[model samples]
Target: MTTLSLHWPAYRLFPYERLLAIAEAIALLSSRQIAEDPESVTVTADRPAAAPRLTYFSAYQTPRTPPAPTVQHLIESETSGGSRRQSTRYSVHGLHEYKGKFNPQTARALLNAAGLPKHALVLDPFCGSGTTLIECAHSGFRAVGTDINPLAITIANAKAQALRCDPELLVAEAEAAFRAAGRSRRGRLLADVRGAYLHRWFDAPMLARLETLRAHIVERDPSVSEILLVIVSNLLREFSLQEPDDLRIRRRKSPPSERDPYQAFLEDTRALAANVRVVQRHTGVCNATSVRAHQGDMRTFATAAAARGMISNFDAAITSPPYAMALPYIDTQRLSLVWLGLVDPGTLPSLQAELIGSREFNGSPRSIWERKLVDNSERLPAAHAALCQRLLEMLGEQDGFRRQAVPSLLYRYLAGMRDSFLSVRSLLRPGAPFFLIVGHNHTVLGGHRIDMDTPALLSTLGETAGFVTERREPLQTYQRYGLHQKNAICREELLTLRAV
Candidate 1:
């Protein structure tokens, strides 16, 4: 018999997290009789095995003092007590702040619960900022991530590369790049259209400094340059005229106070490098080459990956998919996208519209989607189709265009998700688990609030797309702290499905 105790943080976790922590322990330990106490879980088995690597539990049987705190733990502890779920400050996950990224601890726990073998290939089709991929690498699994957003791809790849590269080499190169950027003289601004567009957001001095930093970054060793670029990109919003707190693009009422780009870059780079060192100490040097991030639509990524000779049969998949009428992802990152030369400014609208669950449709595209919904062309599930129809029926003539577009937008979101499910299922081996952490949302139509059960809807879509719905466990969502609190999701669910 073996009794494995959970870490202190596990006892304080939300209800769903506690459930997942126990499931992960049971799977990893292969226990016969599981007993849960206030502080620990005891499992009886024929014989005890070596201490299991766990996400939410200490591997030792007896309570022992926690290991000495590392730089990452110290930094994270200052903000959120370094709890497992709140410990994003560790590793390259803190390289940049990405909106809507899932908790890395949850990803690690899910991976543990899946009980995948070492070196098993995992897939995250909607890999925003590579949370799952980072956890996969930490767990010694090879990972492939695909996202339609180019900026996401860049950040995700940068994070994975940080885990693989020599920590000292990265720090040295970053310091050299910062020095070069600081030394370069500010030159005359370009007279091109791109320059004119950028001028709207950034004053001349900051823009020139950013451009210099970018140039020096490109000049550095290609292997580590991406990490440096991400550092600069994370600073863009703070320096720009855009309101840093708002999710959408809105100019500040008054220009931001003068800020030091050099100081900010130095601080961010040093902190990121320190966290990278801490990650290396724990996970050793992961093979960055084994972690790949592809920029493409999730609905079509499987086909593209297969054509490129990438592995198609993954052991498992996990993702936190965007909500219906999701946040304006591209709009929020437009400045970074243009400054990084990832996409042309004019194409932002089209790219935004391309994202699944995007609320950016207009003109012909909007009309086409509406027509399809009217005709039921996508063969949506009965409940999903009925819900959309009900929402449409509730809309009155007094409703705004955004309200009028609700039903069609919901239709498009579900259809896209259905396609995404098909695509993801095509890449998984038969019977592989696919987990989605999705939030429930609500919308107002004709002054009536209509709740959208997104997790249940997606489960139905998954069933139609060659998956068997396994479980849908309710998860308690964390509270939002700032301007976005009013728009927070009150409830989320973990939907588990098995590819058939």
Candidate 2:
């Protein structure tokens, strides 16, 4: 039998922090070759030579079943760097650009290490951009994901549905839809348009084209229309009058020169269609795994699931919750949300307030420091407790919005996290594994350095919710250089916990 093994640089192995995928890849490659008893592959994470080795050591009888055409194609696709690029095929995943989305490779690697049986149910409560769910589906595991944001759910559903679509049909329909949109001159400003925001980010002619595209998309079948909307949404930020800066929504100083919207849509659709076709060919064996996505708050998902008899049966779960105030997800995709009419401009404040790690707070002033906040603070780990204390102390040192918001935001964020963890715990079967890929943030409060040790804090909190911390693997290390450099070296960590 052919053996496949390699060593990788430490830097490239960050985030997922596991060598299990190497063995999984080998099993996939050698699936049809083994006879009688199916031997397992040994994945070692040791620096045996110059670099860390992802050794897939296995001994097995060969030539049981011939390699299928799809298997041959997939095996041929594996190159020296195939391990890194295999999970993220740049197909349906390229449909939208989401800030703080975890790598699909990480999800796949986690699944490989999870040791769950095929067609097992996996849960991702905070399934931003649906990376974990999509990976689980591709790996032949049924997956269910939930998100509070409707737009995110829409994007995830469209991506999952791409697996069932005919690539040639996708290309043809996308082309016809855009062409028909371009030919229509009845592009008037819709009533739901956030006029000020749209005017600021897009020129009139470009906006007209998008409006026309939206009009045409809505008239099609719901599934087709949803996919087209995702494609259209992806184009907004690409051609927006905004700098290709960081994830946070920011505008450019001047308007950009206009490009043909139809051409851009046509090009993006064709490329995505081709990628989907390739992905379909490679993932034929995983078509049995069911994928379900829901648009709702994760904090209350457990209750909803239990009510609907969808609880406690999940074998595994994986997710990366939003970093503490590091990314404003809703605001980041404001352009798409506004254009798609998914979120109204006036209701943004309420929606933002509902999100965990949100800086916005609309609660009563007295309620901010109530008994509930104190109880939430009590559940925090020691490090988190210190952070909370320091943040609370900062309130006395400052005046105005910063003073009013910081303490409330910190308490609310912690409370929300506690609720989410408890909810997730309820949904997992006893001894089931839950993988969390998360990063921490640093803040200055009361002239003290407060580090939000996310993974460490989460470990402590998981214990309170009947979960035992199994492993804590550090992934990438980031050194801080600016003002808060003293207490600012944060490493993204993969935390594995088991439900009790």
TM-scores for every candidate against the unseen true structure: 0.91, 0.81
lDDT of 1 by residue, 438-494 (tens): 998899999988888899899999999999999998886555223333343447899
Runs of candidate 2 exceeding 4 Å displacement: 1-89, 193-197, 244-246, 254-258, 285-289, 364-367, 370-387, 394-400, 477-490
For model 2, what is the error of residue 136's alpha carbon versus the real structure, in angstroms, after optimal superposition? Answer: 1.0
Model 2 Cα RMSD, 1 decimal:
6.7
Model 2, poorest ten-residue lDDT window? 50-59
- Candidate 1 runs further than 4 Å off: 32-34, 45-52, 62-85, 254-258, 362-364, 478-490
Candidate 1 lDDT score at position 10: 28
Write model 2 residue lDDT over 206-275, tens digit each, in one string: 7877888777777765646677788888878767877645466677654564667778777877777776
TM-score of 2: 0.81
